[model samples]
Target: MHKRLFIPGPVEVREDILKKMSTPMIGHRSKDASKLQKSISGKMKKLMYTDNEILLSTSSGSGLMEGAIRSCTVKRAAVFSIGAFGDRWYKMAVCNGVQADKISSEPGQPTLPEMVDKTLATGKYDLITITHNETATGVMNPVEEIAEVMKKYPDVVYCLDAVSSLGGTKIEVDKLGVDICITSSQKCLGLPPGLSICSISQKALDAAKKVEFRGLYFDLLELYEYIKKKDYQYPSTPSLSHMFALDYQLDRIFEEGLENRFERHRKMAEYVRQWAKERFALFADERYASNTVTAVKNTRNIDVSELNKKLGEVGYVISNGYGQLKDITFRIAHMADTTLDEIKGLIESIDKIIM
Candidate 1:
């Protein structure tokens, strides 16, 4: 049986979107390819609410995350962690031999705006990275509040990992002063994994020009300049298959209406959170809980693996806690094209098995 995915990423793709992948190949350097890419970039700018230029990579969202840190941090970076994905950013900085310091919040907590303010006040960093929504602990950082703090440090290049949140929520990248906002196809975009997308501000591009050793393959500056020079074509042979699917999927998203899509995700998240509270405690703070995924504390100490096996038999599948949180908590993702009715059906099935 084909099980429905309720995991944080690689969420269920619509049949029509999946079919777009089979679209015939086109020459990556052809004008037709450029037109296709330009279409995607135009639509993406609207979705992200940014006037910043768009860049697409064939790798996961991590590719751009690494690129943004490596390309823009000429002095040093202050990396803030709200969960596992946040820590990953800090690690990327270290591995790249970039000067960086990791400031972390307790699991299930948020990276407070005051924390950002205090860090920037010291004037020790020129770039900062924040995870807008973390799937591991199901926490969504308050970017609007953090944006206010960012305004004080005008020189600091603000980078956000919106890999799991961008399409599911409203993030005004320009208003937030985000120099780079990164997301992937696998999450809330309702497409299969392959391509990652980002919006890069002019400020970020200027900062990248100062860095000397930004690595190849994931060089943000090279990618940005190449697209502009080549008219929306990538330096590398791009994932034409994913591009076809994404271009088509963006149209579908528009047809559904962005506001309607966001509201649907919000309603599904609320329903799941209420169910978790009544049955099992929530792992993250209620105030900062994510609208895409919910991590539920395993107060009942149920065998999570067994529950998943049962769910799989019933043609549905969710996720176990990530890393250390495994068995301590279980996750239910409510993003992508999942409807409120579908979410209710999944919850009812779980209730039948556990209640």
Candidate 2:
């Protein structure tokens, strides 16, 4: 039996969205391709609530995260870690020889606004990267409050990794003062893996000019310039299939009303959190819990592998804990096209086996 995915990414793509991916192949440089690209980008701006230029890459979210950090960051970067994705940002900075310092909060704690203010007030960094949602710890950093602190530093470039939260939550990129906000298609966009998107503020592009080696392929400046000069087409043989699905997906998302879609995610997350509280405990802070996924502490130390096996037999599969949390804790994602009824059914099935 094929199991339904309630794990993080590549979540269930509806049949219509899958069919869109099968759209006939088109020449990358043709007018049809440009039109499709333009439509996708335009709708993406609505989704992200940004007027800044959005760039689509033919790689997972990590590619754009690396590209943004490597391309920009002239002086230094303040990398904040709430979980795995945040740590990866610091690694990306160090691997590329960028000046960056890694800061971390306890596994379930939120990175406070004052912390960002204190770090950036020293004028020690010109760029900062934050993960809006961390799957491992299931912590949703207080980006809204953090953005308030960022207002004090007008010159600093703010970047956010919203790979899992972008489609499920409403993140106002422009109002948030984010220079580079990144997300991928597979996570909340309800599409298969292959493409990623990021909004590039003018400041980030200008900063890239100062860096001598921005690297090709994923270079921010080069990609931005190419797309601008050539209309919507990139300097790449872009993944046209992902584009077709994304364009159609965005229409469905908008038709559902952005507010309604976000509300649905919040409702599903709330249901999961309340249910988990009755049995297991949430790993992340209640105040900072994620709307896309919930990480539950292993209160019983039950065999996660065995439990998941049983779940598979029931036509459902949720994620085991990530990295170090493996077998110690497990995760249940509620993003993309997943609905409350589906969530209820998954929980009901798990209860039947466990309870």
Candidate 3:
């Protein structure tokens, strides 16, 4: 039996969206390809609420996260962590030899704006990264409040890892003054993995021009220049299959309406939160809980692996808490195309098993 994914990412793709991936091949440099790429970019601009240049990469959201940090950080970077993905960004910066410092909140806590304000006040960093929705601990950082703090440090390039939040949540990229907002196909976009998209402000592009050794494969400057020079084509052969599916999926998302889509996710999240409150305790602060996923504290000390096995046999699968939180907490993802009915059913199924 195919288990329905209630875990984060590679979320249940609708059949119509899956079939769109079967589109026939197209020459990477052809005008037809340009038309398709342009169409997707135009739609993505609307979805992200940004007029910034849209750049597509044939890698996970991490590719662009790495690209943005490496390309724009001429001086140093301050990477804030609320969970695993935030740590991953710090790791990427270290491994790439990019000058960076990692500061973190206690697990299950959000990265506060006051923390950012204090860090930027030091005037040692020129770039900053904030994870918008961290899947591991199910915490969503307050970007709106953080954006207000960032306005004070306009010269610092603001990068956000919206990998698990972008399409499912409301993030006004331009209004947030985010120089680079990164998201992937598999999460809220409801498309298969392999392609990542980002909205890059010209301010970030200008910063990249002054930096050296930005690397080729994930170079933001090179990617953007190619799109501008070659009419929306990537520097290398792109993932045409994923692009085809994404184009179709974006149309469906719009048809459903952005406000409606966000509201659907909100409803599903609220239902899960209420259920968790009635049964298990929530791991994240109620004020900062993620709309895409909820991490529940394992107060009952249930055997999560055993629970997953039982759920798997019944054609449903959620996620164990990520990293050290495994068994201490478990996560239920409610993003992408997952509906309120499906969420209710999953919770009821779990209730029966626990009962």
Predicted candidate 1 versus true structure: per-residue lDDT over 127-168, tens digit per residue: 999999989999999999999999898999999999999899
Cα lDDT tens digits for candidate 3, 181-213: 999999999988999999999999999999989
Q: Mark the regions of model 3 whose C-alpha exceeds 4 Å error after superposition.
A: none
The lDDT, on a scale of 0 to 1, for candidate 3 is 0.94
Give the TM-score comparing model 3 with the true structure, all chains together.
0.99
- Candidates 2 and 3: which is better by lDDT? 3
Q: lDDT per residue, candidate 2, 115-196, as tens digits?
A: 9999998899999999999988899999989999998998898999999999999999999999999999998889999999
* Error at 261, model 3, angstroms: 0.7
Alpha-carbon lDDT, every model: 0.94, 0.93, 0.94
295: Cα error in model 3, Å: 0.6
Task: Estimate TM-scores for all models.
Answer: 0.99, 0.99, 0.99
Deviation in Å, model 2, residue 183 alpha carbon: 0.5
